[model samples]
Target chain A: MFELLGIPPQALFGQVLLGLINGSFYAVLSLGLAVIFGLLNIINFAHGALYMMGAFVSWMLLTYLGIPFWFALVISPLVVGALGMVIERTMLRPLHELDHLYSLLLTFGLTLVITGVFQNFYGVSGKPYPIPAALTGVMNLGFMFLPIYRGFIIVMAVIVCFATWFLIEKTRLGSYLRAATENPEMVSAFGINVPLLVTLTYGFGVALSAFAGVLAAPVYSVNPVMGNDLIIVVFAVIVIGGMGSIMGAIIGGFSLGLVEGLTKVFYPEASTTIIFIIMALVLLFKPSGIFGREV
Target chain B: MTHTIEKSQADTPGPETQAMLEVQGLNGWYGESHVLHDVNLTVNKGEVVTLLGRNGAGKTTTLKAIMGLLKSRSGSIRFNGTELIDLPARDIARLGIGYVPDDRGIFGSLSVLENLLLPPKVADGGFDLPAIYELFPNLEERLDSYGNKLSGGEQQMLSIARILRTGALFVLMDEPTEGLAPVIIHQIGHTVRRLKKAGFTILLVEQNFHFARELADRHYIVQEGKVVDQFRNDEIADNLEKIQGYLGI
Candidate 1:
């Protein structure tokens, strides 16, 4: 059946699978943005820079230190997390009393500086990170060949996203975090150390972005510019999800990712612009977003 | 100044008791606009002092300054014998001074229980959730409801309950009855009486002469960012003319 309307099962299934994988990253990254914004009340424009750092750090470990993929996967997030904490304590803390827009500008400046420094050192060339030896093969189904690495990426993203969700929504520390975000002065009055909570929240958000970078390194070419375009897309996701709620971020990320993937198959030219268009529509129709409460 | 005494009462003791909080030459500014000028005040332990002032009389600014939430140009604020100038708002809060702003800084996104849980346990001790529930039984029914969803009265109760949870020895409440229903105001009055009976010191900022007369053991009339008049509880009946002139009550 060579009918245009009846697209082949293989093409449809492949696009759907691809959508699900892209959705995974969207979920994790947007979740991070939501969590950070809730407590710190600043959009972390440097999140994209941190994600690129994670990929670069992992690549450096492999090329120079001869460290394996497994170690880089685990250690890069911690290294980037430490860096995030330093940025928070030094750059962000001083600007807390000023308008929140200033912090956003500071982070945007940091992103430029980091991206520039990395580009100066590494150049624009995309470096290949070999798929881990164990995950190199493809699994053959009757209809398609599924890459094991791709499958692993989706699974790992889901697990990380769920774990982060559980930590923020279910734990006592998360409860304290929610409380602090609501009314920090009141929280402090109760004898809870609120500054520490804000710092840790910022660090955790950065760590989430770094973790996404490590996951992306082996799947895509490890490049200095990897996060440059992704950050814009993630921002759109956050806008559509609402800045206040964590779960909204995850759901918005994956759903939009899937929509983008589907558009790529049917209308390739619209794929890039679709998320922004969706964001504008959401802003016009439901300003608070799908899950966001009107503040 | 305009003051009203619904019922003439006897004068209480003078300010010679051990002062819990002392402000000397306290001047505050908001972006170059001087709001509190050489404002001096004293609150002894377990005293209910009412600050009477009209809008822009610096009543709210004084409370904010005491909590270290404002920039002090020149002032010495001592809380329980400790120097308070230059302390962060959070640190000042930890010193057992609970501030309830006129806006009633409610964490609208959080639930009633979550709002109660926000304040860190102060030296007086953290909030006993059960005790708060006892004070405002309506809150117990809406424990899981978001703060903004609560009614005006409920939010006021939640604000007070949140501060009480901090176990603060002293409370600075600004217009706690503003925009509240009469019944809610009566309930707050009862709550204040209960709080006073429990030995907590209070500095209340109010425009309502009736409410102030009922709660205040002493009164200070503020105008042009300075204390212009002072009176004992018994003096309220005699000071009605001054209160009306300044406060337009």
Candidate 2:
């Protein structure tokens, strides 16, 4: 029953836990955006749509095939990733020689088409995805009650983010990716199939987003527009973290989520606008972003 | 010199002599601008061939076209008897033709080791790490440094070392001595000669005629993207005045 800042400890801790959960999603989503932008040099406007597809795919698997949540988690990303690869090879590849604006417009249109298809079938209402029985309980952590599923999500997101970072920074394949990101022409001249690399990178990035969606289905309602609106916030996170920066996106996502959570407790009215405000301030002062190199 | 030329001419396993690379009628364009016009050249096995020209003479463009880096190119670029004109840049590289671009093309995000390891070995005879270290000792010292962090000389060395590690039988070096100190240029000259002596064919692009004169077995004087003249290194000594006139410097 103890109180801190004139608020109950339970309420405060609950908000903080919620913040951490949101932070995990932000980190994973923004990481996907950063990875895609790093090599492809295109802001995938369809990222949200892909994320939504992940959740829908999971739901569809569960309903149509009686597949469980755990299996859906494993399979949905691969399905979505393959779809992303197709989009890159068929749609985004031709736009590489053109202006960047065209790709952005194309992906934006793709987002609409995908959302429209889902809405036509499922409508705008949210569908519930029941949590697996193994994760359907809460753990008492002395200070606060933690949902086992939430804790699992936090751990999984952290692991995925760290793994991606390690893959890019430490490994030989990662070195090729980073090098290709800087100069694909040079990388190709070095005998790397850069087009194949591009396709796989875009696919990997989309898979990451879809993985986050799979994780999110149990927490948020599975809706047609779930990813559509969340993507705008993630874009703000990318801008704040510094576009195309891997570590920056991870840090920016978690920190912004915490800030948003704190705002909800202190000033509920400004919770939605806090991230945008910080983005504007960052743009004004450091347009390259917190982790972005000066062009 | 005649012994090496004749040795290359003989196919008795001395060193696989014969023209290793023959580029004929290479014309390149950048969008609508024609950069290379009817460029023709050849490089015998184990020979160092230098393409000497002033700036904007399409020396680099010639290399680009030959390497298949320029897509809007039409020419016969045959390396190791493989037709390279229709292949992609990567395929050309896979054919044991390594390219060290003019800008050095070092990725700033990669470490010295990563840059060296980026190129896949195209053949069995590529230089290993210890061999590369012995050639460019400075690169070994700065293996952990990022590619862009190295000095101009070290970067150039890394670029050359990178291609050499790919086991490329033939290398297209674009201005290996560009933007370096005189001392470093001397070191590069030494390295180029060392590579040649190791049985690698080199097609060098150089504005430094004096440097080229010392290292190359044959010289191709490129002017306005065309091979204006071809002569032996000994002939360069006799035709120095005329060569300088053609080079305009």
Candidate 3:
């Protein structure tokens, strides 16, 4: 009954809702990257693989133990986050004194090993994780039929991002983290246990990615390489947002997803390349990013 | 060479004369370049001891070694009879040692209040907020401002004010009076005197002989990464020329 700009409202609104869903994942994942990079000073290249593991952990929990989506949701992140702490302590601790590149390569190598192991076990084909019973139906929002589970993803992502921002910005522990981010030696010299704070920060950051993984499992397929492709886009989202800025990551992620979605509606051929184009433009003009300050 | 290994007979702490810190044969290196060869010194309880030397003569390095900040160092740093060489900087701090670095490490992103509250409490009996405010009224006035935005004297006061709240009995001050206006230097000297009266052991590193001579009870002349000589405050009048010769002032 209604058409705007030669495009039907259903198609436009449909893609916009889909864009919001993808935006939720991007916001959560990029937020994790920013937090980790800020405190640990290392690019977590294994993040995508960890996201995949979160999905796998949930899948395994449901398939083998007859656990449901709700329980798997809570368990998967905890399990993955515990593993993250182990990675930080055993693998990354020794390289603390080395250059940032070493940790990046190490995490990248971890990505390969994790991907290889998952591929060996699960094969390239993806598995389908069913939507929970309560969220199976779609809500008719006059403009579009919105999937309830998709809306839940968006709401949950906002809650998580807000909580993380509050923790880093408003609390005393957050003040310690910010100070440590600036100069860890002085923080530790002040008698705060900086290494312990580091491990906990890394664990929490990884858990954010794992949370996104579980959220993506129901919408996307539970595949070993599921996060592999999405993570590249998330990195571009971070670059456009600014490398270590929390607000930048959240705003950059959601807006870019919308841009990508609208591009699909207006020009289908350029949807995938639009984010990279913006990234290149941002790097050329403001290398520190929109929210990042001068070094 | 003549000092004890953290427990020299000359520095033996007793009830009447308590030795707070004893650093013996402290050798430090920045990667391959050795900065400190043999640094032997002692600071008794409530005594303000100054490590007087020219720039780069290992005075700062000695303080850093004592604080366990250096990457590589070999020495005995004892605080209250505890061997501190093997401990981490945080642990050393927990042992009641407060550090006010030469550059005055103040976090730019944090507010002045946050910087003052940055250090966790290491012991009991430290200056409370009201007391710190009384000492440095400028900090209380600039509580809402960002740390790096403060003036140099304010930054120095913030730097020292931070650890004073931690209840640390011993303070390692590296050039607190350096690069300050004359009025600020005089203010710092006044603060140091008050702190001494209140019974805080101080290990000061200074190129300013006049500042050292006024505040310190004893002075150790450090040259070429070693402690060349030491004397009491009364001995300063007898060895003023010798002290000026060593400091090259």
Question: Residue B199's C-alpha lDDT in candidate 1?
Answer: 66
Q: Point to the candidate with the largest DockQ.
A: 2
TM-score of each: 0.89, 0.96, 0.95
lDDT tens digits, residues B183-238, model 3? Answer: 99999999888777666789999998999889988999999899999989889999
* Candidate 1 regions with alpha-carbon error over 4 angstroms: A1-5, A93-105, A133-146, A169-195, A293-295, B1-17, B124-127
How far residue B239's Cα lies from its native spot in candidate 2, in Å, is 1.1
- State the local distance difference test value for candidate 3: 0.89
- Per-residue error (Å), model 1, residue B81: 0.7
Deviation of model 3 at A56, angstroms: 1.1
Q: TM-score of chain A for candidate 1?
A: 0.96
Off by over 4 Å in 3: A1-3, B1-16
What CAPRI grade goes to candidate 3? Answer: medium
Worst 10 residues of 1 chain A by lDDT: A1-10
Interface CA root-mean-square deviation for model 3: 0.6
Mind giving the per-residue lDDT tens digits that candidate 2 earns over A49-75?
999999999999998999999999989
Query: Candidate 3: how large is its RMSD?
Result: 5.2
- Sort every candidate by TM-score, greatest first: 2, 3, 1
- lDDT (10s digit) by residue, model 3, range A27-77: 999999999999888899999999999999999998999898999889999
lDDT string for model 1 (B1-249, tens) is 111111112332334568998989989899978878899898887789989988889898888888876755568999989998888777888888887778787777667787777666676444477767778899999989988898988888988888877768699999999999899999999989877766678999998889999988888889989988888898878878877888886
